[model samples]
Target: MTRRNIEGSFHLSGGDFTNAGAASSELKSILTNLGINPEIVRRAAIATFEAEMNVIIHAVAGVMYYLITQDTIKVVLNDMGPGIPDIDRAMTEGYSTAPDWIREMGWGAGMGLPNMKKNSDRFKLDSVVGEGTTVEIIIRIKEGKTE
Candidate 1:
């Protein structure tokens, strides 16, 4: 069995709009520097960005874990905040609970979760109404070559 390569972890503070995409950006840079495929890196970055934004917009605090292996890059985002009441509803496009102020900041179009799912090769989400949410995003890295 192939061993897992744990890359790093990032801590995100809820409502910290000033640093919303920082973690995602750093992940992208790290992957790029590691000579990963651009396309796979792009997908991972987008998924990470969406997850990070969700933490900033909704959660009280969160941690993002980055893991890599011979053929995959996985990101796990765990948050503490008011969790999703309905994962189904939250998955719907154009469905959001963000306040008007958030929208005014040009975000919260309800696309975060959906976009994350779309970009990842595998996705999983878990939430508790009064607790928090956790999202796992995996992007399969192409073997034997970098494009």
Candidate 2:
């Protein structure tokens, strides 16, 4: 893990569709500036973008934090809203509970989590019914240093 110790946070507004992916993209740029490889940065950006979209579509409001080092990057997402009931089902490739409105927004195809899993080195999810949800993802870049 790189010893960069870079951190940033984004606030996802409730029902703010236009601002989705803004923070993720910003983090991507920062990682790129820190000399993280392009491919690794792309993967982390895509995964983080998906997670951010999930927050906008499913949760009312959310926050995402990015922690970057020379060797590793960690993204933590948290939201308070209607929690996912079945994590197993949500992990499947083609399952979604998005309403008609979200579907009209062109995002209910249920590929978010799958894409995140495919792009990230480590992924974890914690959710409670009627409570909230949190997701953690970590990506490591080889040949990078950590502190």
Candidate 3:
């Protein structure tokens, strides 16, 4: 965008697989229209989708906040659900806490967090056992040509 930065938010509901990827798709369209680099857009899209899916699968409810600037794309997904008790274990690639029903539906293979981290230039995740989880992912635009 021409402005200094753009901000937006998306609401999410757990177990609502019908509209799970809507937020990320909308974000992708926005970035594409804004003329962001393809590589940067791809990374942001991957991270954003992963974060959105995490909330949909694990949280009772949540919101994803995004900030787009000339230098970076940042998205923070905050969920109100059973918080993760082990951040380190959750970060592992092949680990998942998704229920059998979810797995039967072809999700929760345990790559969500890892994919988010891999696609992010910067990533931070925080959770409280009974509170919720907050994941922040930042994808840096190229140093130049980011108007």
Instruction: Residues 1-147, candidate 2: write the lDDT tens digits.
Output: 336477889999767888887888898888888777899999999999999999988888999988876568899999997888999999999899988889898898999999998998888999998988999998987645442
Count of residue pairs whose backbone atoms collide, per candidate = 0, 8, 0
Model 1 lDDT, residue 59, Cα: 89
Which scores greater on TM-score, model 1 or model 3?
Answer: 3
Query: Which residue ranges in model 3 land beyond 4 Å of their true spot?
Result: 144-147
Q: What is candidate 1's lDDT per residue for 1-147, written digit by digit as tens?
A: 455475899999999988999999999998897788898899899999999999999989999999887788989999998999999999999999999999999998999889999998889999998899999998888756321
In angstroms, give how far residue 27 of model 1 lies from its true place: 0.4
For each candidate, the alpha-carbon lDDT, in order, equals 0.91, 0.87, 0.91
lDDT of 3 by residue, 2-111 (tens): 56788999999998999999999999999998898888898899999989988999899999999988788989999998999989999999899999888898878999
Runs in model 1 lying further than 4 Å from the true structure: 1-4, 143-147
Clashing pairs in 1: none
